[model samples]
Target chain A: MKRIDLDIRDGEFISLVGPSGCGKSTLLRIISGLEQQSGGSILLDGATVDRIRPRDRDLAMVFQSYALYPHLTVAENIAVPLVMRRLNTTERSLLGTLLPSAKAKRKEIAGEVGRVCDALSISMLKDRKPASLSGGQRQRVALARAMVRKPSAFLMDEPLSNLDAKMRVQARGEIAALHRQLGSTFIYVTHDQAEAMTMSDRIAVMMGGEILQVDTPDQIYQMPLDLRVAEFIGSPKINVLQAALTEGDVLSFTFADTANNRVQAAFRPEAARLAGIANAPLAGVIHHIENLGADLFVQVMTAGGNLVVVRCDPGGIRPAIGDKVGIVMDEARLHVFGTDNRRIEGSYRLEAPL
Target chain B: MTARSFVSSALRHTALLLIAAFALLPFAVMVSTSIKPADEIFSETLRWWPQKLAVIENYTEAFSAAPLMLYLMNGVVVTAAIFFLQVLVTLPAAYALAKLHFFGRRLAFGFVLFCLLIPYQAIAVPLFILLYYVGLLDSYSALVLPFTISVFGIFLMRQFFMGVPDDLVDAARMDGMSELSIVWRVMLPAAIPALTAFGVFSIVTHWNDYFWPLVAVSSDKYFTPPLGVMAFRNAEAGNDFGPLMAAATIIVAPLLCLFLLAQRRFIEGIAFTGIK
Candidate 1:
């Protein structure tokens, strides 16, 4: 968590995207005040809340485990935050109903719980416990509980990681819609890049303990500032080729220079295509082919012993195994990195065939 | 069912029935002796059914011989007070030992486990001396206060509370519950099975305790059921077998009824705590 400087805007959906153990969840916990950060201070709306307790911080969190009280029914679970806030100690006790004020407040809390349940379409599950509900239903109940509080911000840690694939997709849309309707600041933490890319206004790609880059999903995919960010964000990973900038300012894929002008050239599978072996800058042998009914991905072993995946059309001419083919990358889509792994912003053109 | 499984099942049932009857033989003898006339109890041949029934006389004589009802009431008061105070003390202590992170937490839990090793009788003399010095001897406080801090209850509850998830605690904290409220509102409800198990252990141990009562108090008015039975034997029902057996049966009847009512929860609690 060194030098973590993120300024999330109001009503913005920002995602902390990283692999496991990358300190994303830790950062979220620190923001929610569930955990303390030893070296940094957290400010909410220009006010420092480092010493504030989680209850007073006024931020709601949806844990990955759902964290619903098993003994409480769905409605009671949803009403917990409100009940704790609105009722005094005596009013929250067993004999609270005897007090006129408490009874009226309890009715108000019940109405809030009912409204939250209705908004989440979980009104029918109000009386049922979390144990009896399906994974998707319990997730909604957890959402309902967090939403019922109407906090200033929502901190969710992999909220949909427990659902089945189909439910995860459905829940993804529901959460996105919820963010739009509520228009509150949402800080989501997840390891799945697809979740971050699809749902977030700005995705913060994290690795090790630091945030590598923060940008919109489209910009993050097309123009990553860090080499690792580009490699981590896309499925069927981007390919990195060992290349050297020779004397004539030519990019040679097979030649490794003894001088310090060495660089790593990277490109996505869709940015490169197959060409005649004599005409392209790089050549490779087709290693394997994956046919997914609508798309074909061809894995090629380059002459420099690097495996690069190329996305090909299923209706195009399918290349056979062990055939040598030329690799022609979309020059504009190529991401060039310097020796220090920072993206080099320049136009790299192939002047002559390798 | 297959013949082999049937044979095996029959053999198992037969073995269980033998052990059950063996365990129940003393109780059956006590009940049979309580209902029989004195001369029939002394007969050479063992007979379950009494030739002359002395049920009414034995029961009336047992009730008249000593204040059995007062003894039962004393038993109820002492055991209930001890159990209630124990739960009041045990819940917070166990919650801290199981969940809270503090200085000397491990050391405190170690002390609890150490205390479980020392039986009550070993410390009974010091407890009696302490009660005497405090001028609480021969009173209900003497009976109840000595057994209030049950180390076994703490250990049992701590073990149960350890199984509860930390996420649930965090959730409660996020919901604005104070730590004490979380104990009663969340952990306590989830720990009912363990509480029931500890309750059975505490109540039965205290209700049937004889040595503690004998040493702690001297007044016949403060006598528990076990002490009352002893007093009844030496004072009024000397060598009166039928009345004595009747008194013994009456003293144990309440506990038996209670055990029957809580049998299911007791078993569930035992299994939940991983203690047979």
Candidate 2:
């Protein structure tokens, strides 16, 4: 990763969000000590842990594949870390079952496993193998296995990517609740921005092996530092119109070789509204409409030959396809970007006669 | 079923039975020869059943005339030793070759494949000379030592281990298991079918092995079953076919019982190896 640096706070639920092959999963693996970073060292709680093995790192990981031992029952799989750490070789053997100390340890491990299973609501499925369980249930078992140890942190690599859409929404809430209850450090990696936006305390937007921006979900959506971050974090992506900035902070936009007109610029779809055709400054033909129950998004082919999506209220008059309509740019909500795609400050009033 | 299907089924069964009879014809001859009286054996007429049964005399003489029992015991000891030692050596080697990345890993695997191409018979003379120089000749060491490092066993196990997912090993490592523990506790259990297949191959090869034991051993105490059966063909027992057949039956019985018991698993294991 090219000079990527990140600081994960204690007891914080930080998400690493990016597209595929953006080094988000690789970063998580490096943190878990599963893969070593060639150039940098990782410090856990002020200790350099780069030399430590994964087993000794005192961190638990939930894999995308669930990675449960197929031969073992759910309870046994959950008890594996405890068995490895608390019991010696002889104590884990068949003969050791007869020893009093080993018996006590085994009983303690069993109780811990039961408690973790109860937490995940998978108590009744303790005797079943992973293959027999459904995908969601197997995911719970993987979570139980990771939770039974109560390690320093939990590193999850797209743990819910294998679940169905409905299950993913439910699992998102459950994981957020889990983080709240455990209050442990969680470094979750995912390619889904919605998952990161909804579940993380802070989302780190990664791209091209670098973290573009790190902020809360609201801040990331509202004030993206990079153009890529702004486009990636929202659905029906933020529209960009090619414009040239003239003197006196006046924005000049031209549509299809038409004469340039001065206007206040806005990027977000929600900031544009339909206005009366007589006095409205911008006009576009309605190309398509998407009705998502409460909100209707209208896609318009602007006179500039650019497609722009405008979020319209469901209760308002819906524009028909191929209808020529005027657009009123919300002056206060407009985000002006310079030629470099960086947000430009000192916005002026809308120059259209409304 | 329908009439036509029934007729086809009958034809299939008839074909299978014909093959079974052809396979069992030699065993029938061995049994009939062991039981027939000496005069009946010389008679021109072919007798399917023995006119007189010499079952008791033949079996008793088969055991008493030569140390047939001793030879059978030696065969058991040598084969068992070879199998156990081969597994003990091959499992780790295969696991390393399949999973671990180290210096010379590709070169080492290449050497294993190269060794597989060179038949053991081609190296037998050099092996025998080495054992002779080490003074291990005529002992069980000479019988068991040469077969210990089975290239086929290593190759089979490596192929089997390759099928095991890397996630399992990573999980085991994250569970605080050492490399050795992963080999035995994780990979070994998962490779049981392949191990069973290799076990059958190794045992059958070593148990019926006449040439190796013939070259390595000369003493009566260390003679394996096939060598003992050959001993029954001495000049003194010139036409004594009864005891020879009895000894042959005893020598072949254990392997046949083993194959019958584990035939399905053996076939599955061999089939898995062939696909890889």
Candidate 3:
């Protein structure tokens, strides 16, 4: 990773969001001490933990595959960390069963396992092996295993990626609730922006091994510092148009194949409206209409041959395919980018048509 | 069942029965010859049923003529020792070859593959000389030590361990298990089926081994079952066919009983190893 620096606060839920191969999961692994970073050191609670082993790091990890031991029952799987931590070598042996202290320690361990299972609502599955559990159940078991220790923090690598769509939504809510109940630091990594947006206290947008921006989900969606961040954070991505800034602070954006005239501005689909051709700054033929029950998104093919999607209210006037219409940009909602792809600072009104 | 399926099943059963009979013909002849009296054996008119049964006498003579019990004990000791040592040596080696990354891992595995290509018998004379130099000949060490580091065992276990997911091992490490503990506690349990297959292969080969024991040990005390059988044939009653067959039966009985007891597991292990 190149010049990526992030600070996760105490009891905070932070998510690393990016496309695959963006080093999000790699950064998480480095934090967990599962993978070592070549150049940097990791500090946990003001102590350098980079050289520490994974077991000694006082951190728990939930893997994407939910790597539960298949031979162990759910309860035993959860008890593994406890057993390793609480018992000495001799106490973990078969002969240790005959020792009174060992028995007492085992009972105590069992009680903790029971409590974690009960908290996760998997108390009934304690006796079953991981192979027999469903994907969602296995995920809970993996969570229970990580939670049994009450570690300093939890590092999860795409923990919900394997679940079905419906299960993923429910699991997301459960994990958020779990974080609240545990009140522990969580560093979650995922390629899904929606997951990051909905669950994180703050989202760190990473790209090409660098963290582009770190802010609350609202701030990221509304005020992206870079163009790639703007495109990656939103669905039906923020529309980007090639444009030039002329004198009088005027911006002129032109579509392809139209060198004669330049239209001024770029805006998100929700920031544009269908208007009458005479007054609209840009004209296009409606290519497709998508009715999503509550809102409709209309795709327009402009005269300069660029496709622009406009989000319109379902109750309002809807245009059919092949209908010629003009697009009116919402002046206040328009986002202007300079040639360097940086957000332009000043705002100016459009010129009135003659 | 349908009429056509019934005919096919009948044909399959008939073919299976013929094959089974063909396989069992030798054993049946050995048992028949073992129980037959001297007069019935000499008057050989290909009669399977003996005119007079001499079960007790032939079996007792078979035991008494040679120290058969001692030889069986020796076979048990040597086979068990070899199997235990092989697993002790092979499991860790296989785990390392399958999982651990090091500078010379590929080269080490290449050497293991090269070792597999060389037949053990081809090296027996050199092995015997080595044992003699080490003063281990005519002892249990000579019988068991040469077979301890089994290349076949390592290869079989390496194949099985390769199928074990790396996630599980990493999980174990995260759970605070040392690498050695992971091999025994996690990998060993997971590789049980393959280990069982290798066990059968190892035990049967060592138990029935004749050429190695013949070359390695010269003393009667260290004689294995095959050598014991040889001693029985070299005795005065070597021409007595009934006791000879009885001795042969005794020598082969333990493995037969073992195979019968674990037939399902043995077959599953062998089949799993074959598919992989």
Best by TM-score: 1
Pairing residues by index, what is the TM-score of model 2? 0.89
Which has the greatest lDDT? 1
Q: Each model's TM-score, in the order given?
A: 0.95, 0.89, 0.91
Better by lDDT, candidate 2 or 1: 1
TM-score for chain A of every candidate model?
A: 0.98, 0.93, 0.94
**Model 2 chain A poorest ten-residue lDDT run:** A255-264
Model 1 Cα shift for residue B4 (angstroms): 4.0
Q: What's the lDDT of the predicted structure labeled candidate 3?
A: 0.87
Off by over 4 Å in 1: A257-259, B1-6
Q: What TM-score would chain B of candidate 3 score versus the native chain B?
A: 0.94
DockQ for each model:
0.76, 0.57, 0.65
Across B1-276, the per-residue lDDT of candidate 3 in tens digits comes to 999999999999999999999999999989898988777888849899887789998999889988999999999999999999999999999999999988999998999999999988999999999998999999999999999999899988898888888878877888888889889889988888788888888999999999999999999999999998888888898588888889889888999898787777777777766744
Order the numbered candidates by DockQ, best leading. 1, 3, 2
RMSD of 2: 3.5
Highest DockQ: which candidate?
A: 1
Residue range with the least summed lDDT across 10 consecutive positions in model 1 chain B: B235-244
Q: What is the C-alpha RMSD of each candidate to the true structure, in Å?
A: 2.0, 3.5, 3.0
For model 2, the stretches where C-alpha displacement exceeds 4 angstroms are: A248-266, A275-283, A303-305, A326-354, B1-57, B270-276
